[model samples]
Target: MTDWQVHALKYADRNSRTRAESFIFDDNHDAPHAMDYFIWVLRRGAEVILVDCGYDSEEATRRGRPILRDPRDALAGIGLKAEDITQLIVTHLHYDHAGGLHLFPNATIHLQEAEMAYATGPCMCHDTLKMPFTADHVCEAVKRVFQGRCVFHDGDAEVSEGVTVHCLGGHSRGLQAVRVRTEAGWLCLASDATHFYENVFENKPFPIVVDLQNMLDGFARLHELASDRSLIIPGHDPLVTTLFPQDGPEFCWRLDRGPSGDFNL
Candidate 1:
């Protein structure tokens, strides 16, 4: 397998959120639970594959989540421009995940078939089910579909020789996780499949869930995909940057090098 280097680039943050918003049944719900936004990049020479582009400024305002840096601007930290990305893996259609679909106009999007349907289908009629999604983002994806720029997967499929996406519908109807082969071992980017290490390791599910059972099953699935517990990078955990060695510019962590210190996953 071709070895790839992975970097988790932080772009935005939400510090006011509490544990109740993150975990479904935690006793310490009042405790502060911060979430950091990031867009992951996998590279091997000039080839660049992006995973979940961060939300644009519009989404930040509408959702009350401010951006520390624009997702497009954050790309410069890794010497990449929006036009340079040729492949994108969209974990789900949530506002934070697919909100910048239009930003990567040059890339072919990789998404689960179920995710597209969930975002556009009847399920979105309910406000609770639709809260995390933005209509414009879904429209952008639909436009991409018409433009023949999307590769839809049924469940688990390979995006590249060393990179793959697996459907783990729970947080969102079609939320999936990205797995990549790196020098350190197999590293899995658990995007919303496990928002924090505790969400999986402690058997807690994030509050915004579509299917409770699928969310529960996905925790185990995340562990199964990675070589070690420490290698599993959670989606919104602020600890991810500290867990892995910092690389390139600020807010960027080199996931391919593994953890810099014992995170005690």
Candidate 2:
């Protein structure tokens, strides 16, 4: 079995977020909470798979979240160009996740079946439900589908030998999580499944949930997927950068090596 090397690359973040927006019905909802945006890279030899594409500059401008570094440049730092990516695992269709679909023209996209339906289906008609998604990004996926570059998974399926995706819909109707075989063991990239360590450890749901129960269940699943909590990577936690061995505070953090030290809630 090939041990996949995984790296979490942070491109942007929002320091103005509040706990109220992160957890539901929490007493400290008014306290400050921050979020770091990232796209994970998985590679071992010639196989290179991208987890999610961070949002583009336009989305950053509209959402009031500025990009600290272009995700493309971040990938460049790791010696990968856009064309070098051949497989893309889209956990969901949220703007921040799928917004950069155009950035990688050569990669075949892997996604959950229900996610496409939820994005293009009746559920997207609701403003609140559609807020996290951008029409352009969804359409980009649609375009890839038309070009025969998209692969849909009904539930749990393996995209490659040591890489698999599991549908853990909570934040979105068809949201999924990625599991990879790394040096430490089976590592779970708990994308929106658990936005932060607190979301799972504290059992608090992120405010933007389609199925609250699914989100909660996914947390338990995350634990089951990884050998230890340190092997599980949250989708947007700033603590990630500090907890792992990385070159800097706002760049790539190696996930396959496990955490450098202990972390508490």
Candidate 3:
């Protein structure tokens, strides 16, 4: 059995009004609203895995991102430094999820090859698609690839025992999610495969989705993969803290319980 723990590394928070302008639907004029950027960590045994790397404080400031603190600082609250991480998984290449990668220099990162190609490919000609990414961030990711720290999977691949990555392209071409065996059963991490729980619950696709049909299909797959709805977690929902119990000394909010009664704290 594999044990896991989850930690929230909040890098930024945006007011609802700011994010609503571009994201929320309104019969009236486009009103702006804000959202938050969070990175998560999964720990199993002596191995520490990070789900995403939020933007660095400086990068966020330069980009005019309304942030609360550096993601590294949040990690520090848990007594972990960047180097402490052994593995990193980027569900996709969106800026909010892939920003603070530079902070972890010693990790071997897992990613979908299609995602890397898409982010650096011709599809970027579309402004809507390009808006979610920062060129510098992608470039930095490329550097990591050359440095031999990047691991690209073709489609579905298991990086560890009972931890599997599945292809569920929708919001992005190579968007993927994670499924791990736990004491409670199977837990699926629907990372950006369906941003908020509302998207899946209401069957409303995020307007920014690359393919509407795939988004719907992904939701179905997620439900099938998760033994129970309560075991499924959305990428950016604020409700995770309420649904799971905190288990570590710092920043340890676990997502699932292992066969040995260990949890993803």
Which regions in candidate 2 have their CA more than 4 angstroms from the true location?
Answer: 248-250, 263-265
Per-residue accuracy of model 2 over 1-265 as CA lDDT, tens digit each: 7799999999988899899988999998889999999999999898899999988888888877789887789999888899888899999999999989999999899999999999999888899999999999999999999999999999899999999999999999899999999898999999999998989887889999999999999889999988888877899999998898995344888989888876554
> Model 1: runs farther than 4 Å from truth?
none
Q: What is the TM-score of each candidate against the true structure?
A: 0.98, 0.97, 0.86
Worst 10 residues of 1 by lDDT: 256-265
Give the runs in model 3 whose Cα sits over 4 Å from its true position. Answer: 18-34, 246-252, 257-265
lDDT of each: 0.92, 0.91, 0.75
Q: Which is the winner by lDDT between candidate 2 and candidate 3?
A: 2
User: What is the C-alpha lDDT profile of model 1 across 70-123, one tens digit per residue?
Assistant: 888999877899999889999999989999989988999999999999999999
Q: What lDDT, from 0 to 1, does candidate 1 have? A: 0.92
Considering TM-score, where higher is better, how would the candidates rank from best to worst? 1, 2, 3
| Best by the lDDT measure | 1
Q: Compare candidates 1 and 2 on lDDT and give the better one.
A: 1
lDDT of 3 by residue, 1-265 (tens): 6656555555666665433333335343355434445677776777777788877767777777756767777788777898898788888888888887778888788999988999999999999988888888888789989999899998899988877898888889888898877666888888887666766765756677787788889989898878877777777765565556665534446666522233232
